[model samples]
Target: MPILTCSIPLLLDDLTELCIAYLRDSLHASNC
Candidate 1:
């Protein structure tokens, strides 16, 4: 198996979490 595929999911999950956190932070900031 390739190391790239093994890490791809983790990378994607991290990116998704980052985007979600950024969006949540912006939304909460707007409410304040």
Candidate 2:
């Protein structure tokens, strides 16, 4: 449980970054 708690934030951060990159790519694709 302690390890899961600690890793949750890191998982969220990675997910957030992936979402941002995906959005950026989508925007660029639409623009082009």
Candidate 3:
């Protein structure tokens, strides 16, 4: 349970980064 708790934030951070990158790419593509 402790390991799971620790990994949750790391997983969320990775997901947030992925979402930001995806959004940036989408905006750039639309601009072009």
Candidate 4:
């Protein structure tokens, strides 16, 4: 994985941000 090439913390943060954004979009879609 690219995470193996870069810093662990940075990879984790990036993954976390992606998850949060995905969940937010799902919630909005369900509301509509």
Candidate 5:
């Protein structure tokens, strides 16, 4: 249970980074 708890946040952080990067790329494409 403890291992799962620690890994969840790491996964979430990676996902958040991916989402932000994707959003930035999409916005840049639209502007050009």
Candidate 6:
């Protein structure tokens, strides 16, 4: 249970980072 709790946040953090990166790429594409 404790391991599951710890892994959840790490998974979320990775997902958040991927989302931010995708947003940035889209914004840059729009600017160009």
Worst 10-residue lDDT window for candidate 6 reads 1-10
User: Per-residue lDDT tens digits of candidate 1, residues 1-32?
Assistant: 23334445666766666666776887899999
| Residue pairs in clash, model 1 | none
Clash pairs, model 4 backbone: none
lDDT of 3 by residue, 1-32 (tens): 33345445566776666666776887899999
Model 3 RMSD, rounded to 1 decimal = 9.0
Q: Could you give the C-alpha RMSD of every candidate to the true structure, in order shown? A: 9.3, 8.9, 9.0, 6.7, 9.1, 9.1
Off by over 4 Å in 4: 1-11
Tell me which residue pairs clash in candidate 5: none
Residue pairs whose backbone atoms clash in candidate 6? none
Error of 2 at 25 (Å): 0.3
How far off is residue 5 in model 3, in Å? 19
Candidate 3 residue-wise lDDT at 16: 61
Give residue 7's lDDT in candidate 5 (0 to 100).
43
In Å, residue 26's CA in model 6 sits off its true spot by 0.2
lDDT for model 2, please: 0.65
Q: Residue by residue across 1-32, what tens digits does model 5's lDDT show?
A: 33344445566876666666776887899999
Error of 6 at 12 (Å): 0.5
lDDT of 2 by residue, 1-32 (tens): 33345445566776666666776887899999
Candidate 2 local Cα displacement, residue 21, angstroms: 0.2
